[model samples]
Target: MAKGDILKAALSNPNRGPHQTALIRSAIYKEMEQFTATRRLPPSLDASEICRILAPIDRHLTPDDYDRLHKFSDFLAVIDTSPNAHPGYHLLGEKLSADLGL
Candidate 1:
């Protein structure tokens, strides 16, 4: 699945709010940056490479977690490219998902 697809899934989790999603995404990105810097890896590393690096830090996360993380990363990319990006979109998705018992 694409990255946005995974983010949409993550957003489906009822426990996550807009603020929480934003914080999670920011933390993930920051960690990615630090991982890249420390490993002297290329800035354009692929998703698998990123997953490998993140796995050690988030050992409790299953393979599905990595999949969701990659998706959320993609969603962030789309938001970054948009002119009117807002965290509300993710928040709304989460709220709706919760209401639906998803």
Candidate 2:
């Protein structure tokens, strides 16, 4: 899952109005910037920050849309931690799998 995929989902999400889309877009870019600088995903990669950013627009999103956003969160978690980018390099896969319950 490329970062663009998440952004595209937000851009085309029919359940949200322009304001909600704009806010999510902003939040995504912010997190993206953080990743570019640190190569580290946010805590848990659950998109918690995105959800927090959405708090103001929570009532505006349909339940499914909200869930979709979280699915993006879960997707991020999977993408970042899967395939063991450096398998066995440092027992990293074992540790991540245990940490993420994968």
Candidate 3:
């Protein structure tokens, strides 16, 4: 599945509480590491970086997981704030913001 699909699946899973989400994020980081090692790509970027960038926006996330969730939230927020935001993203963001009373 696409990365977006994986993220969505993880987000939508009923069993995915905060702890489970952190675990899933860790797994994704590991996979990214393995993939980078095998592919011998540049040493600059990896999943861990993404995770680090995303953690702050997700209250349930720990410091170690900040980048990942931060990146995810940034993406979501962009989609949420974009003038041409997709209908699905707009709707989802609206619902989420409402639920959080943001």
Candidate 4:
């Protein structure tokens, strides 16, 4: 995604607070793409670095908003590695999905 690109959520609806689903200045979508392309999981992805990258994305993204993303599952895991991201979004998924670097 472009640097100024905005990943908005519930665009047609305004019931949610503006900041809850804001337009963050980031290239995270692209970063996540590369991260996923590596086909790595957990430690391989460098949890600390992942969390650092996710800080901005998570601030503007609410839990419910993420459910709509096409890459929510994996993205959720990566972003949740950050202590700053929203909680309860991090789920320990299947152990043998073949994407765990096993």
* Best-fitting candidate, scored by lDDT: 2
Predictions in order: lDDT: 0.45, 0.48, 0.45, 0.36
- The residue ranges of model 1 lying beyond 4 angstroms of the native Cα positions read 1-59, 82-95
lDDT of 4 by residue, 1-102 (tens): 321122333233355554433322233344444443243344434433333333334456455445433243334345525444322223223222334655
Give the per-residue lDDT of model 3 (tens digit) for 1-102: 433444544544556356656755664564453341222222443465444433222666544443444344334334424554232333344445655779
TM-score, prediction 3 = 0.36
Estimated TM-score per prediction? 0.29, 0.33, 0.36, 0.21
User: How many angstroms is residue 12 displaced in model 4 relative to the true structure, after the best TM-score fit?
Assistant: 8.2
Query: Going through the candidates in order, what is the number of backbone clashes in each?
Result: 1, 0, 13, 0
Instruction: Please provide, for model 1 over 2-84, each residue's C-alpha lDDT reduced to its tens digit, 9 standing for 90 to 100.
Output: 32544445545555444545444545555444332222233344344443343334335545554656554554445535554
Q: Find the candidate with the highest TM-score and give its number.
A: 3
Better of 2 and 4 by lDDT: 2
Instruction: Extract clashing residue pairs from model 2.
Output: none
Give lDDT for model 4: 0.36
Q: After superposition, how far is residue 87 of candidate 2 from its true place, in Å?
A: 22
